[model samples]
Target: MAGEDEIEGRNREDEQMHYNSTNLSSDWPFNATNDLTNTSMAMVASSNPMNNASCSSASMIDSFCQTPPTIWDHHPTNSQTLGAFSDLNMQNNPTTSSSSLGFRKGNLLTPSWPPPNSAIKRGGMFLPPPTATPTMLPHTLSQFPADSGFIERAARLSSFSAGNFEDMINPFGNVPESSMSPYNNRPVQGQPQEGFVNGFKSTSGEGSKDLPLPVDCGTNDGSQPKNDARQGGSGFSGNNLPGESEYSEGGAGGGGGQDETSDEGLGSKKRRRSDQDSDYNQVKRSPQTPNESTKNNTEIQQKGDKNPISVANKSKHGKQISQSSDGQKEEYIHVRARRGQATNSHSLAERVRREKISERMKFLQDLVPGCSKVTGKAVMLDEIINYVQSLQRQVEFLSMKLATVNPRMDFNIEGLLAKDMGVSGTLGFGADMAMAYTQNPSQLAIMQGGIPGLGSSSSDAVRRTINSHLMAIGGVYKDPNSQVPNSWDDELHNIVQMGLNPSSTQNLGSTTPSHLKAEP
Candidate 1:
């Protein structure tokens, strides 16, 4: 449990960090200090003449127009002009376009340029050297989307630093190192010392003025690029920017006061331009770089594997859950006999239960004090069943005594058992005779120990009536002839006839032999 909690906390912290990072990255474009400002402003200048007029009106210096006139010659149109000039020169001299004009590209310059643009470097990638950095090369690099192009350019620069040249290649499968390597089998050393190979200011023993800058970076001199290409390795020098030109001419309206822009506007514009220049620098300076973007993506994906829940997901079921009562919630497993069950258990059952409970509670109250404050219903329900059983046995004995005198009296001892006990009553012949004896002293004395038989009774009430009759049977019998009570017949009966004493029914007179006659 603790380990899970720890892992959860760590995951939350990581998620929070990633969220913040994402927000920051999104807002980055707004504060982008590395946008190609010079290119944007140059485009903006053409679109809104007000911007141009505002700048020129205020005497804003043209920073983008800072390069010299010769740079224009690097343009294809300018090259056509130069070619025409050469043809014009041919008319003056029979020597030809060769000696007078310059060295032929085949004899010197390759008609096709050296060092391919990157894979992302498409349409208009190769620009006039006057454009300088690729991002700020011209206002017309639209082969890639703005964000994608900018990011790719950033990646291209990083690639240079990290020496990942292969991935940053031209569509034609050419990269910078492909042309730069001295040997076919050599791999890119990508080392700091190799910086000399690109014609940085490397020392050559003790002579030569600054190594003559083996490559021309357009702005390096006041000469045209074709003229600059005559030197060894100059045609495709690694150090030279792709479109190196000595200078670029400012157009007629360049920096002239006819434009309403001001000097202060130049700084702001240049500041914005400088930012663009840096962005371009990064693109042009690009070498093979690290796959940081991929690594960060993978980290985010792996982090997802570690943490599955999101704040939104956790809160999806926002309803609070609470129990309405301290009770169980369950499906009805059984459906009982509704009102019938209630009716079956008579109200008397409740009364009896109350009695039992009262008894138990009294016992409990005595056994344990204040702790057992039994409710009345509970106390009444808590009966000792054995006590009820004993009472039933006594009632059964009394019932039997009544049954002896009457066989029809169907005594149900169990039913008679006071309802609370949940038991029926019982009966015995001896108890019935004893009950009869209790009702009459003389009859009881005559047949005190003898048992009597029973009579018919259909139901409980009838049986009770018969039992009552048995009790009376032991007493006097009213004679039909007189209102007088004769001496009671002590013997019960000889030949049984209803209500006549068996001992008194026989007649003895002198109508027979002397032995059978009465002795006088």
Candidate 2:
């Protein structure tokens, strides 16, 4: 019934052509066969219920369908070969769905890249299809919901299922023997006996002498994708193309039911691939699936991959003295060699600089979320405390180092009322020492927990430890007098009022500040 409808549509067209036998062929390269085929396809499409009403009305004037035929064999009385189709009214009359007409029209000339949405760029920006580009609002492709929908749909279709992937990634079935199969025995130079075979270089099982020239191969040339023979293969010979036998088959069977398969397959391939966004993935980098980054990192670690060689070497060097240490002795054995002391005074000073670089590296490592196992809590806290303490120690070390260099600088530290130590505490260093320590008191307290007090022996001892810790961190000399300077009482009025006496405290029950030695 469907085939009759198509035939009837063509008969109607031929009936009209009988009127004048118009030489549409003169203006168009397409001949009667082409016209007949187009008319049939258009009519078949118009038979759809959606197209009936429009085609019914349009059936009257459309030159391709309704115009009475002009002379098919001769030029029409009209001189202009194209004049027959110049009936723009007739052109507008064949009211089949514009979508179908457009598709046919576009594919009529040549099957092209899928519409912009379907035709994904192999490796560049996603251009809205040629059709859509002209109509699209000026914006990024992501701005279009329609394009996104097509992208998702294409992704859905193209996503290879495990089974499909098995097909694509591994075309031949099970492959223990594909590379060394019997087909590969291309023995040289003779049509060997029935059971014999030729190996790779031979043109046939008979071992022909001529070998075809090599062509561009893929990442896995001889080893993979033999199924993509259309793209070319390492060993396939042109003997595969049919010559005499093909024509004989066509003459005998009128083109095998299967012979048409090539054309049909090509057509189907075009139609299948013409979807909107076929090359979308090609143009874009394949995004890692969720969890992919973590998975890849985990796999690498499990495989025991190490840092690049140079990096591995540097790490080994840093760890060498410790790794080779016998017990903690040599490892903790702080080298007291003063070779670099002028540049960086103490053993501790050099260690602190190394620690700072290590801490920064840890910070960088923590930037990647799942890539690291470190929470950084303990390490970070230790780094902060250690850094602050080092700054404090460096301040004190400079003071002592300067005392040896210049003595005048101490005056600025706390207005040293009496010249205590000169030559060692020269005019030059006193000011520098004070600026280093007391000028930034807030910073000092934040480092040491609080300022050093001078009330009792225990209080003095605590002050000494704080300064000792500072000197250790900074790689400087710990003063034997790490205690708060005994002159604290004389230097500040507040300290004097607080009193070094220690006697008034226990008996204060009867005396508040109000009851103290009134007015002098």
Per lDDT, the best of the predicted structures is 2
Off by over 4 Å in 2: 1-40, 46-374, 377-382, 404-520
- Stretches off by above 4 angstroms in model 1 are 1-44, 47-68, 76-158, 163-520
CA-lDDT, candidates in order: 0.22, 0.24
lDDT of 1 by residue, 1-520 (tens): 2222223223322322332233223323322322343244334423433223223312221221221111111122222333244332211111111111111111111212221211001011111112322322222222212322222322333233221222222210222221211111011111111111111111110001111111121233312211221111211222112111100111112111111011111111111123333432243235332233223213322222111111011111111100110011111101111211221123434645766877776775655433255555444335334345556897898788767845542333312211101100011122233234346655433332221211122234333443344334323332222311110111111112122222211110111112112111
TM-score of 2: 0.15
- Worst 10-residue lDDT window, candidate 1: 199-208
RMSD of 1: 35.7
Could you report the Cα RMSD, in angstroms, for every candidate shown? Answer: 35.7, 30.1
Tens-place lDDT digits, model 2, residues 265-325:
1111111112211231121113322242223223322322111110111223213312321
For candidate 1, what is the lDDT? 0.22
